[model samples]
Target: MSSPRRVTLSPTSSAASSAGFGAGSFVVGSLGGGSSFSIRSTLSARACLDCFSPSVSAMGAPPAPRQHQSEPATRQSVQSPPIATTAVFSALVERAQTQYAKSGDRYIGYRVLGDGPIDLLALNNGSNIWIDRDDEPHWAHFDRRLSSFTRLIRFDPSGVGLSDPLGAGELPTVELWTQDALAVLNAVESEHAALLGVSDGGPVAMLLSAMYPERISALVLMNSSARIARDDDYPCGIPQHLLDRFVNTVSDPTGGEDRVDDLALLAPSLAGDPEFQLWWKTAGERSAGPTTAKALDTLATAFDVRGILPLIRVPTLVMYRLDHPFLRPGHAHYLAEHVAGAKLVELPGRDHLAYVGETEPLLDEIEEFLTGTRGGSDTERVLATILFTDIVDSTKRASTAGDRLWREQLDNHDRMAARQLQRFGGRQVKSTGDGLLATFDGPARAIQCGLAMCDGARQLGMDVRVGIHTGEVERRGTDIAGIGVHIASRVQACAEPGEVWVSRTLTDLLAGSAVTFADRGDHTLKGVPGTWQLFKVEG
Candidate 1:
């Protein structure tokens, strides 16, 4: 079985806590066999019922179905977790779309899974970063494990299963995959989450955990290896030539399903299981042709976690089978040795895939790791003003001019707005697709920055809106966040194109800046609590 699919706001995500997976989804479909009869749609976004009351987004003629023959599932029902507060879900979806659209090819879509404990973005380990709800019923063991936590999300990578495929050059390394994972987390707007990797997913989790230690709470590796290429002394490892050949076979969209070693090495117990093989074949085919093969070629000689090991201070558990082939037990041992305090767990039966084989012990160990200990928190906290700016009718404008001209215009817009922001003594936060987020030491500077950004963008014939608010913000590693940030975004959404809106807090903070506001009166924002009195800049 594969790991869960994902979507998060930040760490690059914070998990969703709700009854089922579709907390933010409205559409549904069915995939797999017995798994077919009983389909599990992306857990309905708990807020879908609330979205148009109001909601949320994706694109494409979704790629073909990730079909697989399946025996009746072992029928295990997972009790869902609690619902996410509006703040959390809003943050999750806002980031989900933000990240999903970044797929190297096609527009990626997502389904919310509010079934588990800690949030999990089952980053599809294939060509596309996407998920098919139809196949959910067939992966019970996967659901049960993920549902055991707070929130779990599943999605296609890019160019596979329901997602459009990109060219070979699109994804050159695991760094791209890791970036895809980060995009999903950013999509969910999560700041931290546990990393649970399986098969080819192993290296990604390790990289994410190492590169951004603060975002990950823990690490779980199943049937994964640090490296597959032979290390002179380790001849049992995958030969480089064999690795290249396998990639060619599996990734070829037109290639026959003469399944290869990577798939073969996955489930020692299930390799011979026809249903399992079909599922693997289907997952790979649906994502992108021979994509996994391309990944293997990259994986064999690409990853270098040596410098990243000791930096991984999070609690970690490595699970591997004694008889697994792709990644030998020795690699697992080597990983534990290098991962500081990581614990090595050798499963009794030799099943290369962590989702298969004897699962209780592996899960038990994971449960202990997550619930038993906490890591050191060097998180810094602060108070500041958060702002969100967006271009109005940006898509239309981009479409009007085509990619080349539109890109040039967009770059100019970014530069001009950034220049004004610096002049106003404001800190540039981040960009929102075609928009921007910024911070200010005072409300006056924030308002001035917002107004200037709108005016500057206007030069490019791009009308934009701005929103600002002041409140307590927690600085987690390098990102700034809080309810204040969410409120600021909503306030921006409320503004008319070209207008700069400010939360009451901002109005109060800017006693010195030459900015005036016309009260729009108190109104309720989607997902935010209570009624807020927003003011529009009259200047």
Candidate 2:
């Protein structure tokens, strides 16, 4: 196979500067036969992929073949939060005003968030991006982690999501889909972005990187394949019989229950959870109708990007679960082998979805490859008391006070909270919009801070809830992140107006202190692991 051409830009180059390509960042504009280029500052691709294995579990048994079984009647009616309850979901719903990117007469829907140094375009796995809002817990894991480090842009291609739906009997082709991605990039004023493709979106990312070398800086393919059908050479493809069976199943849209079969294959980890199953079913129905789903399935069966793999010139990372039921490890191996300089990282999980299981490992790999640093708690962690406080019914309060008045009241609330933090020897980490997050060296100090803040807010005629937890937290630059932080936030959510809730850890640490507590009993914190013993603090 011929090599791709390379074009380098000096720091003073107008083209490079205008494109927002940084000084040390490598840019592969085009490739010529047998050409090679060097990246001066970036870590070697091999090093990034091989460095992290301690956190990853050993490979387990391969996943079972997905069975077409009807979900139990009891499981079908499971209850979940309204999609708008999640902040990100609510934001996406309110700001559904997507920018249009013209591809032919049809326009693709796109949204941009964050202003981090790197431009990251997240490609959907043939699902409407909005459907992700249905399961905020699952999707937030990716949105928060990725948006924290990169200028993230998410879009729905033609025939999916909020973008223009396909015409009757019309199916989307690779070329058309690729054009949709390009149009979104143009609309977002991004010269180049690292494409992060999940599941079926991988082939599209591969095609875009090969065809539009200049517009793509790097490629991240997660649990995706070049083709779906098994042939003599590609034994990993789904057997012809299985493909036909799956197609027929999806082609016939019965009820949301029927989608469980597909969900079982796509995300087995979530299939058993009644709440997740319901959300998945609703999301499937909302993302595309039966006809569109069938068309997408048909298009997926015809995908063959083996020829395009070798043509890709930029840095590439291929991540796949060792036990993915549909897309096998063989397919991942084929991609890594064919794509020049591609790094293949086999993660331990049966779930095909990227957001499932330990997502931090995947995020760590991506951050390291793109920015030469693995972000998250991997940096530094310390045991500290975390405090989370929030004003109750702040939205209603804001509306009642109007914008100017609300701003002044919020300012007063913040100042009072800061003063309490200072008096209680707590460090104000950051404001939580309507409240604040503070840290303290001791649980006594944290409890005192929360009590003072609550009393002060009550005096201001604003009710607030405070939650405190003592645990190890990872320091991420100016902010802190970890399961501990999540636990504290969840604890705060459990508190009623004017109440101070804390974890058992906090109560235990404050044994000698004057702080007293009434047991709140063991409660399940949403999106957090395990039942936590909480307490209501009393002076």
RMSD values, in order shown:
20.3, 27.1
lDDT of 1 by residue, 102-187 (tens): 54344555555543334556654442223332342224444445444545566655434554455645443454455556555666
Candidate 2, residue 223: CA error in Å? 1.0
List TM-scores for all candidates, in order.
Answer: 0.49, 0.53
Q: Write the per-residue lDDT of candidate 2 for residues 407-445, one digit (tens) a residue.
A: 999999988988888787788889879977888755666
Best by lDDT: 2
Error of 1 at 93 (Å): 17
lDDT of 1 at 375: 55
- Native-vs-model 1 lDDT? 0.54
Stretches of candidate 2 exceeding 4 Å from the true structure: 1-85, 88-97, 125-127, 131-135, 255-260, 373-539
